[model samples]
Target: MDMDTFWNDFQLVRTGNPLVLNVTNHVVTNNTANALLAAGASPIMTFSSREVEDLMKISGALVINIGTLNTQDIGLMHAAWSSANAMRVPVVFDPVGAGASTLRTSSSQELLSLYRPDIIRGNASEIMTLAGEAGQAKGVDSSLGADAAVAAARALAQMHSCTTVVSGEVDIVTDGNHVYRVNGGHALMPRVTGLGCTATAICGAFLAVNRNRNEAAVDAMALMAIAGGMAGAMAQGPGSLQMHFYDMLYSLKKSDAERLFSVTRD
Candidate 1:
C-alpha cells in the first residue's frame, strides 16, 4: 500500500465524516470519542442492547472494545455485531486485557466465536492469549514485544479469517498472508491511559472509508504511530502528550503523513 492510498482514505473520513459506532470501555469513552472527532469521524458510544441495532444501521463502522466487560455488554456486542453484519458494515474488535483474567479471556473468546471481526487489534500479550498461546499480560499491558507474537497473530488471522494487529514498540498488522510493520510511536504513549483503546476507535474510523481490511488496518496503525510521534516530540510528559495527541490528529495533513509514516510490508 502506498501513502496516496492511505491519504485518500483519510480524506474520505474528513470529507464524509462517517459515523462510527463504538461499544467501547467506559474508562476511555471520552478519549475515544475525542480521538475519533479529531480524526474527522463521528463517534457514537451507544452500548445499550435496546438501541444497538438501530444505531448500527446508521453507522459506517462498528468498534467493540472489551476493556471493561459485563454480561450486559456481551449481549449488546452480539446485537451490534448482528446489525453490523446485516448492514454490511465493518467491525473492529479490540481484545483488551485478554490475558489478565479468566473473565476477560473468556469474554474475548466468546465474542470472537460470535462474530468474525473485520479487524482485531490488541497488544502482543492480548493477541497471543487470544491465539491460545502463553503471553505475559500484566494488567492489560504487554510484557513481551510485538515481534514475539507475529506468528501467533498470523495464526489468529488465518483461523478467524480476519486482519490481526499487535501493537507494541513496533506495531504489526497482518492478514495471515501479508504482514505490515508500522514504526514511529513515542514512549510516552503507554504512560497515558486509554491510548490503546483510542487506537481501536481510530481503526474503526479508517475502515469506515477503506473497504480493504488489511489496508485499512495498516493505514490506521501508521497514522496512529505518526500522530503519537508528533505528539511525543512536543509533550512534556504523559499529561501534555494526551492533549497534543488530539491536536496532531486534528491538524494532521497528507504531507505530514507521507513524511512521518514509517511502514514496511512483507
Candidate 2:
C-alpha cells in the first residue's frame, strides 16, 4: 500500500474513534489502555465474564492477552472469546509468553482451537510455540527473532484462519499466502516490558476501524514501528522512549510515515 492509503487507515482510527474492549492481563493493563488511547481509540479494560457479554455487543473490537494467566482468567478468556464470536466482533489475540509455561501455551492453544480470532499477535517464540514448533521464551520475552518464525506464523494463520503478526526487530504480518515485513522500529523498543502488549492493543484499535484484517495488521505494525523509530531517535533509553512513543502517536502525520515507513510485501 502507498503512504497515502496507509495514512488514511491511520486517520480512520482517529476520526472513527472506535471502541476497543480489552480482556488483557494485569501486567500491561494500563500500558495497553494508554496505547489505545494514544492511537485515537477508546479503550475499556475488563475481564469480567458477566459484563463482557454486554460489552462485546457495543465494542468495535476485542483484545485477548494472556500475559498474566490464571484459572479465573482462563474462564474469562473463554467467555470473552465466545461473546466476540457470537457478536461477530473482530477479536485480536495476543499469546504473550506462550512458550514460557504449560498453562500459557495450553490455554492459548485451546482458545484458538475453539474460536477463531480475527488476528493473532505475538513474538517469534510465542508464535512458534502456538504453531506447535520448537521455540523457547524467557518469561514473556522471545528467544528467537521475528524472521525465525515466518513459516510457523504462516502455518498458524492457515490453521486458525486469522492474520498473524510477529513482533520483533522486523514485524511480520502474514496470512498463509501473503506476507508483509515491517521494519524501522527503534532497537530500544524491546527494552520496554509491556511494549509488545501495547502493540497488540494498537492492532486492536486498527482492526476496529479497518475490515481488511491483513491490511489492518500491516497498518498497525507500520504505525508502531514508524512512531517508535521516531521516538527512539530522541530518547536516551527505554524510559524516555516510552514517553516519546505516546507523544509520537498523538501527533503522527503523513510526512512521518512517508519518511519512516519501510514495509515490503511477499
Residue-level lDDT for 66 in candidate 1: 85
* lDDT by candidate, in order shown: 0.91, 0.90
lDDT of 2 by residue, 1-266 (tens): 55776799899999989999999989888887888888899999886798998898899999999988988889999999998999899999999889898889989989998997899999999999999998978888987999999999999999988999999899999998898999888999999879899888888888888878898899899989998999999999999999999999999888778999888998
> What's every prediction's RMSD, in angstroms?
0.9, 0.9
Please identify model 1 stretches exceeding 4 Å from their true place.
none
For every model in order, what is the number of clashing pairs? 0, 0
lDDT string for model 1 (94-149, tens) is: 98899999999998898788776999999999999999999999998989999999
TM-score of each: 0.98, 0.98
Q: Candidate 2's error at 262, in angstroms?
A: 1.2
Candidate 1 deviation (Cα RMSD): 0.9
